[model samples]
Target: MNTQMTYTAFLDEQCLASGPLVDVATAIQQHANQSNATVLIFNDQTGKQIDLDISGSKQDIQQRYAEHPETVKKVGRPKLGVISREITLQQRHWDWLDQQSSSASAVIRKLIDKELNDPNSESNKMLAKQATDRFMSAMLGNMPNYEEATRALYQGNKEVFLDLIRDYPKDIYQHILKLSAYAF
Candidate 1:
């Protein structure tokens, strides 16, 4: 079945409305749902779509961010900002790291790396398993240009992606469109 969703997503100066969506975030979400396959749309004033994880869970969202690390960390209500030096690491996180055979800093780094590595590892499992799973997702089962893809997604340039595939044969384009999880 297909999910139809439309919402008023307000970006710089206008509201874009699209429907039959699962949830309506802010006005930014309207443009996000523009393409039929876009499950998540992030309104970046920076003129880009941030890494995406449609799951909506905080951990999951963070994982998506990991697969695509934002070089320009802009502080705003938008994407639950990255953990900077100013932000204190959670105590429970520290405790979890202590229980495991790793360092808390390492854990955070892994989270970020995983987001940059595997946009699909948006969900977290048990602590240990989550780390390993993220690693594998970013490393193993990765595509020929997974890293490059991650960079493009981070850059949030759909135009570039469009240009890349613009010359593809009809068969290849159809094949790319066949993936249920893929966006434009």
Candidate 2:
């Protein structure tokens, strides 16, 4: 099943809401309306905070979404903001790329965009693993079985990794799960 991007909103150290990204604005607004609290929205995949521009009216929001510029490349001269760059590759690499694709640049760009756009790709899984490591180090370094958990995470042993982190604090464990959700 396909899942929409999930966001978690926090008020101080307490979790206010965790749901689809589109619902975060309503979550934040509800939290603010109920209590004098400011919300911080975080992407569940990367654990990075996102700032929402909630000052605009409904029409302004609609206009912005309607006029959103496309970033993906089309079958023509690249996007409006695309800049040409000079890249030097080894002769063999250039020859190989030329044999595989119409143009070396296009092949390289396609490879990059493929990795960037697919969260389930191997490159992205590696990134999620790295994020899990960072989070584990910060929050679980002093906990038991840290080394074992790290090993299991890197080795892609899901059962062992889960078992190793089973005794961790609930919030930290949940955050770790969120961070490593895409790693496998």
Query: In model 1, which runs have C-alpha deviations exceeding 4 angstroms?
Result: 1-84, 121-184
Candidate 1 C-alpha RMSD relative to the actual structure: 16.4
Candidate 2's C-alpha runs over 4 A off are 1-6, 11-22, 53-67, 70-86, 113-122, 133-152, 155-157, 167-175
Estimated TM-score for each candidate: 0.24, 0.60
Q: Which stretch of 10 consecutive residues in model 2 shows the poorest summed lDDT?
A: 58-67
Task: List clashing residue pairs in candidate 2.
Answer: none
Q: Candidate 1 lDDT, tens digit per residue, 25-48?
A: 322233445544333232211112
Q: Candidate 1, after superposition: displacement of residue 67 in Å?
A: 22
Q: What is the lDDT of residue 171 in candidate 2?
A: 68
Q: What TM-score number comes out for model 1?
A: 0.24
